[model samples]
Target: MSTVAVIGASGLLGRALVRELGTCAGWRIVPTAYRRVQGDTVALDIRDAAAVAAFVERVRPDAIVLAAAERRPDVCQHDPAAARALNVDAVRTVASAARQCGAWVLSISTDYVFDGSAPPYRIDDPPAPLNAYGLSKLDGERALLQSNPFGCVLRLPLLYGPVLDWSESAVTSLVPAVVASQAAGARPAPMDAWATRYPTYTPDVAYVIRAMLEQHAKGQAVCGIAQWSGDEPMTKFDIAVRIARALSIDARLEAQTASADATPRPRDCHLDSSQLDALGIGRRTPFDVAIGEVLSAWPAPTPSS
Candidate 1:
């Protein structure tokens, strides 16, 4: 039985990976958390190099799936040091430790690495991140590849599914706000129409990782960068309208042009998953079907009397 350590195991993506990977046979799953500790998940800060080294020495996992990072652009813009620490420095730490222990690494990255200037970016596209968050993640990717050439980098887009809080994911966060506006009689809440995004499902990402792991076990080369994004490219407003229609909510969503946010964001950093497709690694779930599934699992909004 091989052991797999999932850093940031309590996060939205981490939780989905844990749930999905747990079902696979012949693999022992070890979940590690930082702030929130839950069932059998060990607490360890990836930013601390010494601690990470020690943890890796102790567990000696066959693979380390790094799902932890400072994901929010606004937060990264406000505090770049923290972002660099978690996104870049921590990644280096994990990769270094994994390399020493002869463990393969699958680091989770984002589509933000590409400037929105180029739509439908390929795996080999030169990264020109538009924000601190993207830059940090790009740096992390470099660090991982530098430290462990045998490792894999999985670049993902906006993900949503099984979040502890609405704010945890970009897609799911819209639900509470839309519900609130509807309750307050605030019809047509402003939503961004300028920038386009692919709202990929978290479970789909987990499936991709599972496939990669299986390939690695079979001694298949799964190194370098691979992307998996949602098939449909829609703006936030488009997503809001779909959500409203799905739940039969009477909330009107006004389409507003994407403004100059504190952190400059790409207008359409859509990713091309041709590499993953070639490898037969993952499947794309339609956005409407995925959204309905997510909403069904989420807590229903309280009806206004």
Candidate 2:
């Protein structure tokens, strides 16, 4: 069986990857992270070149998925050095390690690399990042490509799903906030922004990775750049309203004051997944259906038995 290693296995995306891989055939996972998780974990920081090299040599994995990064734009803006260490340098280290180990590497990236000036960006478009986080990711992608020509660089948009822990995704963090707001008599607010974004489900991302892995096994995969996102494009306001509707609540949303400084969010960070779909690798889930699924899986209140 081929062994796959996830560097940040305890994260939201990492957890989803692990769960998705459970259903795929011919692969066992070796989950590693800086912070230990409740499984077969090895303590390794991707920023430390020596440590990363040693870990890769020791694991000798057939494939390495690098999902660790300082993902917050505000945080990256505040601490550029830390972001470089984790995002750029760490990626370089891991990519080098993977190249040395002859392991196929897949690096998770973001749409933040674009200024959001162009909606529905393509994979081959020239990247011009507007923030430290974006710059870091762009640099990481370059490092990976330089380190190994046969590695995959997957650029993703907004991601939503259950949080594996506190240090997971912001989209995951919004779950309880919305639920709590509803519990506190706060209804969903409507948004009227023309700007839209593609929110990729965590499970869908894992599925793409699995497909990419299978293609890699067949030795017919291209390793340049691939973009993935939900098929449907909707404004933030639309998503919030949909979530409320999914909960069987009245969709009562109002457009709030919009500002550009709201976490450096792109006005329209949509992606073109036509090529991905044509390759039989993309699965598009409607926003309404996804919201309903998310709401359905929500924890139910327990009654005293």
Best by lDDT: 1
Clashing pairs in model 2?
A: 189-253, 189-254, 190-253, 190-254
lDDT of each candidate versus the true structure: 0.88, 0.77
Cα lDDT tens digits, model 2, 40-75, are 777777878998888888889988999888889999
The C-alpha local distance difference test score for the whole of candidate 1 amounts to 0.88
For model 1, how does the per-residue alpha-carbon lDDT over 100-198 read when each residue is reduced to its tens digit?
A: 999999999999999989788998889999999999999999999999998989999899887777778888778765766676655656888888999
Give each model a TM-score. Answer: 0.96, 0.89
**Deviating ranges (above 4 Å) for candidate 1:** 184-187, 303-305
Over 4 Å off, model 2: 165-167, 180-194, 260-263, 300-305
